[model samples]
Target: MSYVVTVERVEEQPAAVVHGRVDVDDLPEFLGRAFGDVLRTLATQHLHPVGPPFGRYQVDGDVFEVEAGFPCDGVPTPVGDVEPCTLPGGEVATTLHTGDYQRIGAAYQAVAEWMGEHHWQIAAAPWESYVDDPTVLEPRTIVRFPARRAS
Candidate 1:
């Protein structure tokens, strides 16, 4: 899998989010619950997702702190574990990854290498946009990192 990382500007997006701290091996189940709850909250509040589901992750030891949700048309009323948040607007280093999620680390590595070669620094936490359905034979995800000049 080869990635062509590029820099582009993104607009801030309102979202209904659910944050969780779970074992790395349990992330998928956690994301399922989070996304489902967020969707339910959106429906109840009459807010709609503007784009695909997205998640931001940070790993520590064997656990991951994940913030998962959807880029929605409007901020949702906080309900259950869902709360309103914004996907920050700024220039980003991004690339699309096509393959199994198990090998997605390669895509992140590609973005890091590309950024190092271009002298860019990640200025905020990175995220993944779940762009394709799970049933798709080749699932695609967009990986992005908010960025700034190295110095």
Candidate 2:
């Protein structure tokens, strides 16, 4: 799939989050649990999601630490494994990927290449916004990386 990378400013967003460390093979299960708990909590609290679900990844070889959740209005009270948090936003390099989730790493690589070509530096952990339901025939996602000009 083709992707266009761009730099954009984003505002801080509130979300229900669950953090954990898991291997790439376990990502789907981790996301399911994290998003499920958050969605369930939101329903019980009458809170609605304001945007797509996302996962911030701090990658370490085959295993990674991830914080998964959905952006929502003001923070909801913590419930079960879900906690209230904010996705700090600023200048970011982002690109939309349309295909299977297994190919997402290519999107990340594309963004990193874009950053390098543009002399930008990654400022924080990268994240992926799930723009469509995973069960769809073609899943769409926006991979984002907080970035700034290289010193």
Candidate 3:
């Protein structure tokens, strides 16, 4: 349960998301295919691993966000390539997870439970910050869920 503090801005993003119900059991295969698809499309565009994508945030059902990034300077490799958009920075609740994307759900559950205890309302969608090369590392991601103390 390692965690780090960070500040990120959410920019105007139109990246294509692999929308589906992804459980711990389905991560590896899904990530492999998703990254591969994103990379293949973005040939000249280098796919940077911001962090491992795991965990679940219930915006409308449990939505799971995954890794890989396409910065503003980075050319749009795929049709759905998302540029670094505007992200509102403030006090955020975050946690880090190392290895096995399947176990990410527990991390999300942990954060949600922690929020409950602290009386915080989830303000936005949960996002995973990739910290390594998905093509290289075993996989490590920072799960951040925006929150505000409940009134």
Candidate 4:
């Protein structure tokens, strides 16, 4: 599917997250568990979430170092592996994908293609913020890559 990539400035958002180095095959389960942990942490600390859950990934071979959590209104007291972290704020090349999670890679591909054609250099690990419930037939997911124009 084709995507219309946009460059937009986003503010850094505080989040409570659980971090892990997970094999690709186990990512789904890991993210589910991590998200649950984050919610529990927020509840224990009486914090409210601000937005949809997100998973930031740094991939190496088939293993990924993942930070999975929900954006929160205020920083929460650390709970076990769930702690506070800030999502990077800056310009990002992004596109929305609406379909199965398995095909979300195409959204990333489209963003990368747009970035390459525009001489935008990736400034950090890319991430995806899921914007709708997975139970929906065509849920929207925003694929984002932090970037800067290359000299």
Measured by TM-score, the strongest candidate is: 1
Question: What's the lDDT of the predicted structure labeled candidate 4?
Answer: 0.91
lDDT score, candidate 3: 0.54
Using TM-score, rank the candidates from best to worst. 1, 4, 2, 3
TM-score-best of 1 and 4:
1
TM-score of each: 0.95, 0.91, 0.55, 0.92
TM-score of decoy 1: 0.95
lDDT of 3 by residue, 1-151 (tens): 5444343344433232333446545666766666555545545455443323332333434543444333233335336533233233555678777776567677777777877777887887776665665565567767777888899
Q: Which ten residues in a row have the lowest lDDT in candidate 3?
A: 49-58
Residue lDDT tens for model 2, 1-151 = 7789999999988888998999999999999999999999988888889989999887799998989999997789987788988877899999999989888999999999999999999988888999999999999999999999998
lDDT per residue as tens, model 1, 38-149? 9899998888989999999898888888999998998788887999999989999999999788888899899988999999998899999999976788999999999999
- Candidate with more favorable, higher TM-score: 1 or 3: 1
**CA lDDT, candidate 4, residue 32:** 88
Count steric clashes of candidate 2: 0
In model 1, which residue pairs have backbone atoms overlapping below 3 Å? none
